[model samples]
Target: MFVTDNFHSLKQKILFFILLSPLLLSAQAFRSYSNEFLTIGVDAAGLGMSKSVVATTNDVNSIYWNPAGLVGIEDYQGSLMHASYFAGIANYNHASFAMPIDKESAVGVSIIRFGVDDILNTTELIDSDGNIDYNRIQLFSSVDYAFNFAYARNLIFKDVKFGVNAKIVRRIIGDFASSYGFGFDAGIQFERNSWKFGLMARDITTTFNSWAINEDEFNKIKDAIPGENQDLPETTEITKPKLQLGVAKSWRIGRMFNLLSEANANMRFTKTNDIFSSDVVSIDPAMGFQLDYDELVFLRAGVGNFQYITEFDNSKSLSMQPNFGVGFKYNGIKIDYALTNIGSVGNALYSNIFSITIDYSFFRP
Candidate 1:
């Protein structure tokens, strides 16, 4: 009787977990509608500086962060970055190339890919002999990719620049579902002496994701999992617009050291029915500092994504993410490394990123 009772308790727990899984998944899906992989900072330098690059970027990697900074690139530049995220469970990769079209204009192209590999597919249904079948299990992967083409030009004013990015996005889940999206971004920057300011409008026209699902394939797998049979959606997901504003100041310390500080605010506006919340607006702020030695070594640190949570009607708490990085430069090549702390969303996770860049200038006779 005790054994039978224990079995019943175990079954109850299993059923409860199965029932709760969908709710958790639904929340994640809703968040991803507008907060996809592209929003994640790419290069190690940007991530290392806690994504405070809006006003301090001046390389090919700026194609992903703030395109207006492309005007600061005086030569042809190329960058590549790779991140081992979530303790090897996933990978993020980015590459970009930028070149000057004239004294007043520059153009760049970049690509990003984030994905997980070799995820096992399992079913709850038992085999004929009442034993689990391991040999018949399948494996799959999920991936997200984005391609961006960007252009930047100095306005009639020498210290002001304007830029735009046109991008295509794709998401795929094994062989069951896929989504395609297109979006554009615009930005402006103003610089004078050691001070710089920037403004970026993300998804200025709003981004729309159209999903194409293989219902038959999904249903087959769903039938094997208890309480998992649900119809797939045949609709579109739209992402609203957001604005980013930033300012930075730089100072030369002595003859061999330089100090730079930056602050940024991201403002998100959404309707009552949007995925974020009923609140019409929200703001997230970040700040960082960089110390450079003789233009060869750099140290960076920052904090961002402050959140306030209330529990039990009496408990209130705050959370913040911290990041740090180091880099080295020689000749025209630069290498950077960064570590980012991601709070306990899915296990206590941290991301490590590495990136390299090369620059070359053509001399005009």
Candidate 2:
């Protein structure tokens, strides 16, 4: 849903047809939650939240965000993210690990958890007692393991890397609801000189095979609609994929400074299916600066199509219209963090990401 460039008059027409071809096929939009509240980028600790810059494999976390980045992983790398939000009522945590399996192969795993506290459980429709029981909370967890099986002697004298992953997801909702699903993701990454480009396609095949509902709640709803078929409205199965494209460039500005710029676009490719509904192809443009001292530090800022979800809002002030983050590097290890404000859907959004990276150098053959 964006515009790029054209080589010639005939090239423009050909490019238009190839890009719009996906609309001819079926589509599914929301692969995750309706809000897609999983933050805009990678771990909050890294500058990725402000930009889509995973093509170069700067760290281990990129494997989960873009498997193609795994081709750049050297030796072993790992990272962890922990964040608090909504006045400390919610928490997000994650850890990712990637290791070189061989000269041209690498594998990685990631675990992420989201928790909401002090959720008042109610029996009747409305709150009868002013003080509801605050004895429990809600929890959501997902674990993804990806193996980067990459091999490329050279493509026309250029290095090319391809990767794919199999992911499993699980969620629990305060004993009231729970669902688990299996999905797959694939990507290609390339890095040459100061330029990096990557493409990632997710949810090629996904199935939320099981959903458990509370027995008492199911009976209540069934009784409310006496003569009707009363099948649960949330039991529909979905199978669709989301494709994203990203590119980045980093320039050595001076002896003690570096400037990096990146751009990304995400879209839902179906035109006729309800699953392909809510198409909002958003582009995130970001700029980052690295202060090269004895210890490396990074500063970044950017903006995108993030507005509001259902839990929190910030429409008053700057309105979550911009994204910002910082990073720190020691030796070969790095850490990143980011924050965004979305105040439209009654929810506030926040994420904290941390990652560690190890570097290995290979002389040009």
Candidate 3:
């Protein structure tokens, strides 16, 4: 009876969180800050499916998407993914390994890095000639990194699983400034036959970043541009919790064909200027479809990031982005590729991602 009561209490908490999330936001101005890299999906498979894998994720990549899905792994697994973001101007990489501790529990660790390389710092002090001396320029880069440790376990209630991720985040801009933060995520998954449901709460404790700046170095480059106001360093940045909910269904079409479809909703409780308007809340909906041929090869497609805009004159517009990918499995190795659409920003941009996964069981001995 105690276990039953706790289960009901958890359910109530989850419902309350979902219902009250939007109301929790205040009518504050939108701002952007560090750890934005966390918004990027890491795996090729999930990116190809427009990140609608919250319910369908069942592999090592689950370390980033939905930790509860880690309970679906049959054994030990490792995966690596790389993407050429923004036409090779930036790089995004992810790696993870997961091992089952018991029949009902698992643990995983993962790392993610996203950054640009060898950017020429044009703000260096001018040379004697004052011809915008190229020799004074130095090479620097901006990078973001996150380390995640996750754990998942099935509950006494059949088909229900819970997971959590504790992560450390660091962001750097050459030697001028850096920020460090710690955050946590929690997730729940439920599976019944071919149907799955998932919910993830990110940054449940409101991630906080403490920034340290090299004021001397920054002052040297301040006002490098004519008539430009210098930027003052920030001491701290805070990110509020976000929520994702998803549902998936699978069907066997015949002896050699199988199909899966999933839908996901992403909600941000924080105010962000990047959205349509100065709304205190934001929501993005995504959908994906996958077809598996004998469980050997898979074709996938998805659409997401539908933003609705309202003009001052009461005009409305909508923007939709789509992504596609394919996957092949041989023996214990699986390879996946995805082409993600970046909308019509600056002459049609797209990202190419490649990922590989190896699955092996340590219990064979």
Alpha-carbon TM-score of each model against the true structure: 0.84, 0.67, 0.84
Candidate 3 per-residue C-alpha lDDT over 269-297 given as tens digits, one digit per residue, 9 for 90 to 100: 65542233345667778899999899899
For candidate 1, the lDDT comes to 0.76
Worst 10 residues of 3 by lDDT: 19-28
Better of 1 and 3 by TM-score: 1
| Candidate lDDT (C-alpha), each | 0.76, 0.51, 0.78
Best by TM-score: 1
Tens digits of lDDT, candidate 1, 7-100: 4445434533343233224323334345357778778888887888898787898788889889889888999998876788888899999999
- Give the higher-lDDT candidate: 1 or 3: 3
Q: Cα miss at 39, model 3 (Å)?
A: 1.3
Model 3: colliding residue pairs: none
